[model samples]
Target: MTRREFILAGLGLLGAAAAGGVYSYVHRPKFGELPSGDRLKRMQASPHYHGDHFENLVPVPVMSEDEGGHENRFVATWKFLFGDKKGLVPAHPLPTEKTNLLALPREQDAVVWLGHSSFFVQLGGCRILIDPVFSSYASPLWFINRAFAGSNVYTAEDFPEIDVLAMSHDHWDHLDYPTVMALKSRVHHVVCPLGVGAYFEQWGFAKDSIHEEDWDTEIKLSATLSVHILPSQHFSGRFLKQNPTLWCGMAFITPKRSLYYTGDGGYGAHFKVIG
Candidate 1:
C-alpha cells in the first residue's frame, strides 16, 4: 500500500475500534446497574439528594473546581489522559508480601491491604472486607485503570468467610463486579452508601443481605461492633448518570479500638463532624 493509504487505513481502524469500545461500554455487565424503585426512593429520601443527583456536604465537583473556583479541570484531565505520563507510575515493580489470610485465627485482630482500595480486616472476631476490588483492572473497559505489578497478591479465595462486606461507593475501583461475583458465596452481609446497594442487588446479591444507609447513619453489626457511614466530599457514576448513588467513608467502632477508611473525597468540614 502507498504511504497515504496506509495512514488512512490506520485512521479508519482506529475509528472502528473507538466505536466498538463505546458500544461495549454501554452494554457491558461490568458497569453494574442503576438505582430504581425502592432503591431510588431511599436515595431520594436522603438529605444529600438534590433534584437529580446526590450532593456532597460541601458541594465539591468531580475533577473540576466548583462555581467560585476557576474552570481548569478540562485542561487538567486532558493532560492527565493524553499528556506526558512521567512520574505517573512507578519505574519498577513495588515491593510486596503475601500473607496467609485464612491461616489467621479468628480472635486475632489484623488488617491486610490488597491492592488499590481493597482491604481485609479481622476485627472484634469478625472478618470484615472493604472495597474488595480483586480484579486485575478497575474500569468498564479492561484496558483502563489497571493494577500495578505485584500489587494484588491476594484474591477472593484468600479471604475466609466475610462477616461484613463494606463498600464506600459504587466506583469501579471500589466496587469491582468480577471480584464481587467471585466472592458472592463467601460473604454474609453487605454495607454501603444510600444508593450503592442497587449495584449489589443487580449483581445477584440478596436484597436482605445489603444494609444501605445515608451518611452519619450508624449500623450495629454485633453487640460490640458497629459501623458509621460517614459523609465524604465526592461523587459517583459509571458509564451513565452522575451521582445517582452516594459516596462515603466508614468508621468501624469496637469496644476498645476504632478505625476509619476514607474511601474517596476531598478535605471538607465533614471531616470535623466525623471526628
Candidate 2:
C-alpha cells in the first residue's frame, strides 16, 4: 500500500477507537448519574456548594491552588500512568481471614474490616456498614487499582441486614457501584453528606431512605446512636467534575463508645473539630 493510504487508514482506526471509548463511558452504569432537579437544588442549598462546585469549610492548605479541577486531574492521571510506584502493590497474596457476618451477635458491638476503606461496625444495637467496596478494583476500569489476591473474599451478599449504610463521600473507592447496588435491598437506610445521595436516588433507592445532610450536622440514628458529618480536606468527583459533591469524615457516637472514619482525607483541623 502507498504511504499516504497507510497513514489515512491509521487515522481512521484511531478515530473509531476514540468514538468507541466515548460511547462506552457515556452509556455504562458504572459511571453513575449526576444530580438534577430536587437533588441539585438541595445540593445548592448547602453552604459548601459555591457556583458550580463544592468548597471546603476553610481554604484547605492541600488544595489552595485547586481553582482548576481539570488540570489537577490531568496531573493525577499523568502520575498514575508514568510515575514511580515501586511498592504500591503487593507481590504476593495478602493474608486474609473471613468472618461469618450473619453469625455475629448484633447485641454485642464489633468491627470488621472487609478490605480497603470498607468496614462493618455493630454499635448501639445497629448494624452499620461503611464504605463497603466489595469489588476487586476500586477504579471504573477493572484493570486499574486491582486488589491484592485473597483480600477480596467478601461480597455484598455475605452481609446481614444493614441498619445504616454510611457513606463518607462519592469517590469510586468509597462509594462502589456494584456493592451498593447489591446491598440496596439489605440496607434499611443510607447516610451521606450533601450531594452524595444523588447516586443512591439514581440507583433506584427510595428518596425517604436516603438521609442527605451538610457538614457539621449530627444525625440521630437512634436514641442511643448518632452520627456526625464533619468537614475534611479533600475533593470529590467520580468522573471529571471535581467537588461537585462534598467529601467528609464521620464520627459515630454511641452511649458507651465513639468511633471515627477519615474517609480518604488528608490530616486537617477537622480532627479537633470532630472532637
Candidate 3:
C-alpha cells in the first residue's frame, strides 16, 4: 500500500478509538439506576460500564515538590524494595502489630476508624462493623503491596459477638476477603446491598443469615436500631470485567439519632437531596 494511504488508515483507527473512549466515559452508569435487578443487568451488558475516564476532582500532588525531603527518602526506600532493577522486598511492607486495633471499651458506646472505609461502632450493647478492610493492601493479587502504615487495628479475634456485619459495596477496599473470612463464625448477620450477598455466599456465610436490600430498603436490628441501604456515586469491579454486582452507601438509624456513611463517592447533587 502507498505510504499516504497507510498513514490515513492509521489516523482513522486512532479517531475511532478516541471516539469510543469518549462515548464510554460520557455514558457510564449512574447510581440511581442500580437498585432494580433488571436495570443492573442492562448496565452490565453495556460497553460503557467498564471504561476509564480521565476526569480528576482532587489535584494530583507534585511528588517531588509537594512531598518535602522526607517523602523523597521514603520513595527511595520504596524503590530499593520494588524498583524495576534491584529490590529486596515488594512495593510496601506488611503492617505489624503496632497498627492493629487492641480492645473495645467495655462501656459499649464508641466508634473507631479502622483506616480507609472500615469502622467499628459499639452501641446499645451491640458491636457493628462497617466495610472492614484489615489487610496490608487492597489488591486481588497477593504479591503486589500493602498499606504503608496501618495494617489492622483489630483482627477477628479481637471482636466479641458481632451483631451485624455491614458492607457498602463489593470493592476490595470495602469488602475484604480475609476480613470476611475471619468474621464468618463470629458474625450473626451479614447486611449488604443487592447482589453483594453473592460474595458472602461464596465466602461460606450462611444463606439464611445474609440480608440483601435495594436502595431505600430498611432492616431493623433491634427495638432501637435499624439500617437502610442508600445510594452512592461509585462503580464496582474486581477484575477487568466490571459491574457484575452493586455498590451503595448506608444509613444507620436509632431511636435517638441517624448516621450516614458515604462510602467512596464523588460529590454529587444528591448530597443536597440527602440533607
Model 3 global lDDT (CA atoms, 0 to 1): 0.67
Off by over 4 Å in 3: 1-107, 143-145
Query: Candidate 3 at 139: error in angstroms?
Result: 0.8
* Candidates arranged by lDDT, highest first: 1, 2, 3
Q: lDDT by residue for model 2 over 1-275, one digit each (tens)?
A: 89999999999999999999898886677677788888889888887899988987677643223566433755666778678879987888989889999999899889999888889999878899999988888888787777788888998779999999999888888999999998988999899998888889889999889887888889987898898888888888888787888888888899998888887777777788677
User: After superposition, which runs of candidate 2 have C-alpha atoms over 4 Å from their true positions?
Assistant: 1-17, 61-76
How does residue 48 of candidate 3 score in lDDT? 32
Better of 1 and 3 by TM-score: 1
TM per candidate comes to: 0.87, 0.87, 0.63
Candidate 1: Cα lDDT at 13: 100
Separately for all candidates shown, the number of backbone clashes (residues 3 or more apart, or on different chains) is 0, 0, 5
Candidate 3 structure quality by residue, lDDT tens digits, 167-272: 9877777878777887789899888876677667656789888887766679886787788876666766555434555566787787655778886767765566
Per-residue lDDT tens digits of candidate 1, residues 39-109?
78878888899998999877565666657888877788687657886877788888998889989999999
